[model samples]
Target: MKAVETAPHEYMANYVYSNSGLGAWFGAARLVDATGSKRGSFRLNGETWRVTLSYQESGLAPPEGGETPDGTRVDFDTLREFRLNAVVDDEIGERKVKALIQPRWYGLESESGKSVARPMWELGDAVNVRVNASNVEFDTVETAIQRAAGAVTLDPMYFDDRNEEYSVVMDAARYVRLDRDVSGPVHAREGPIARMGHLLESDRSGYRKIVQDDTERVGYYHTVTLGPKRVRECFPDHRIPKEFKHYYARNAESLPDDHPLAHPKVEASYQGSRWDETLRPVDHDELADELEEAVLATINEAGLPTQPLDDDGLGGGRTYVEDAYFEAKTVDRSRVLPLNLERVESDQRNVVVRQLANGLSPVEWDSLKTLVADGGDVSPAEIADEHDWHPDSVRRGLRRIEDMVVREQGSVALRSHYVAEQVVEALDAAREGVRNAMGTAANAVQNAERRSLDERTDELIAFCQSNGIHIDEREAQLRVRMGNLTGESWSELVTRLKRFWTAAGRDPERLKESVTHYRDEAGPKIRQARGAWTGGQTLQ
Candidate 1:
């Protein structure tokens, strides 16, 4: 065999390991020197190595596949010439070597005219694996590294003035990638893979290291013995989002069949119970409901990055959020309350109490009590009318009972008018306590709010009075300010706005009800704008 091709530097020591659990991982394998000053290190991702070399009694021995016969004294010169090319630090036989690397260790080059080092372990230490970092903190930097993933071409539209264009050294492997919420003057540590350690062929000009004598021999021997390997490695990193690892194997029907994420080939292999259930198709109507729910949840969750959508936060990224008709739909997940109150009383063994509400007279109370005792039941509406209490209050009181039962699954249920009445009484007590607290709280809150309101109103009124707003400046000067309200504040804002319109000689009510360019759709439009205003973007 050709000497250089089959040239092997047998390891002075051996490391043996095996996995009984059906798996073993070889992260990175490189034969490097002891002190890490020189190297013969080679990247061996998963490959095995075979080396044959002999320590000659001679001044210098070529590094190749040749076994040693114990006839020669360990010629330290020829012996130490074989360097480890596939290692990080210098090792003596089996001693561990410390390895420290920065992010830029991958981009170093050899100095020109540097002879290809045949020195063993010493050479591995001499190998250059430098990564030039332009200050990791982005200080004095208006422009920083950028990595654009999935883009076929670059666009400089976002840049304005002085330094506009961004350059990437393709040979240096300097690249930019997009990160979530990245915009405007970003700091260092913003770029992908901020720092790393390095090891290169000896001739390559790169980082230098201090090499001790003993380390030199050991490093040289190691490099000549083992080889090199290229493999992926874990590193200390800036925080990365879970979405970066979207393996996409959920029953998230939110992703359409045509979407890449939904394609069968794209999903990560998952064999959970949910996966088994996902295959069983529901009836058409049931499937429709499920699909609708999935869509609503997908859309709702898209606007909220904080709360996870499901166990797998891999479903999707955020989108603008807006909804038109927000009707309060009743969701009775459990049928806790039967239609009649008789079951409640019956269920409670008739110990359940009864009470009259809605202005029931003494006569009516007696009659209603007798009726309930005789196994009769009445709707909340009926009791409200009988007691002259507003049906709404009756309903609300009844709802408290309903809520308790529903919330606790019978941990506590209002079984009768007596039970419902007790619940209402407790609620009233709490409400009264709150009211008492409000009496004290009211002054402080009112004073603070008044001060704030005065300032805001003064600012708005002064600006409007100073400017030609709401009324003609040449005519009567006017100032408009909002007042404390007994009704909806938003509706009051409209009312005040109407007064402004009237002062300006326009129809007040019509203007308040106007569905013009920026009036009717303003609320939803503003909400949409707020949703879309990601980092560095604003409403304007």
Candidate 2:
């Protein structure tokens, strides 16, 4: 038997008209022509009955084929069949039904421009009676129910005979259900699939929407077959069984394009994607070991010096790899061999020498030397402008050179006659003086100690008065340093005072040690004078 496709509307129309009332029983009876047997026997309601079916030609051609315009010839035919069968099942009892079968037709045109008819019996519908009877009319509700029941009994056979048509309807229903259950949730989760749906809805071509709809329909069919639970299990909130995680991941990957879950957008959002990234097993220790081995091999090949291990065969607390890594990072390339600055080129040597001699930073000396080399007799302002230095800084550097000249040449009046060589020598002398001053200041601060608050205050007053230093700034500095000093000897304070005078460009070396001695020893004499004024009793 052949199977055919039948639209639901057409199938229903045929079922209602051919299988209504007594027509349903006759609909299953096979019609006989003169060339075949005219009678057949079938069991109905557990009773045997004989029936005859005959086709009466109406002598009419099916509506005259429209005139084949342009000499186009088309042939068409519709064929129908009826069969009766009985079903004996222990559960439902015996039942008999007649089935009405019809072939669905499609038109074909031959290469010769002649129209051909192709009859598809597989693309057809079968309607069956519901009751077990030879001849019965379904007029009342009870009888109609009985007839429907008999028809259902015959469905399995009918479906087997018309499997293609049955499959078509079943597949469509399955798709609709899948779209509602599976695709809906998937589309909600997956951005890309949702976008695709929107695109389909907005598409003007109609063709694209049709294609997308078909794809979705097919996807739904496959999803149904795979079972919706497989897809749902892989969702983030679902607790997939440990053994089933891999299975679910595989299923998710294998979903067809019609399924929104299978869409790239949707797949990217699945928990499986994250699981694939992080849950995969890794041998971290093995990788670390391999890396260590590779590094040790490279170090040995390069003949690099490694940190020595102790007699216990351990490199301190670190592994061989760690020590090697440290050595690799900290090894001094410059100290690998001695570097003689004297043997360097004259230009490079000059850069180094100028930096040290002028006490200028490398950047500052480079800028200054570049300017002087380019323009002889550069002004302090011009040097400051060229080097982005403050005018005061440039002037101070010039004054230091002048001071150096006075100190070295033993002539304060010979500053105007200084030559370039003398200027360089002066800068060097100034640099040495600044270094010595900084060293002395650091020593004084380090050695300074604190005295009792009252003692420090008296000492500050005496020092200010004796030096005639009326500067509030110096007085403030002395007070601050004295308050901070703790247990320092008087000599430390003297050194601090000497530094303070030296910073004022004065020679403090000539100050008598009697100055501090007078302050320290005068404490007793002053107290005695106060006691005498208070009438000899020791004043508090």
Top-scoring candidate (TM-score): 2
How well does candidate 2 match the true structure, expressed as C-alpha RMSD?
38.4
TM-scores of the candidates are: 0.14, 0.16
Question: Given candidate 2, what's the lDDT at residue 456?
Answer: 33
For model 1, residues 508-536, the per-residue Cα lDDT tens digits are 44443332111222332111111212222
* True-vs-predicted CA distance for residue 60, candidate 1, Å: 99
lDDT of each: 0.22, 0.27
What's model 1's TM-score?
Answer: 0.14
How does model 1 fare in lDDT?
Answer: 0.22
- Error in Å for residue 136 of model 1: 52
Model 1, 279: alpha-carbon shift in Å?
Answer: 23
lDDT of model 2, residue 271 = 25
lDDT of 2 by residue, 154-243 (tens): 222233221222221000000001112223333331222222222122112221111122243322321111111222212222221111
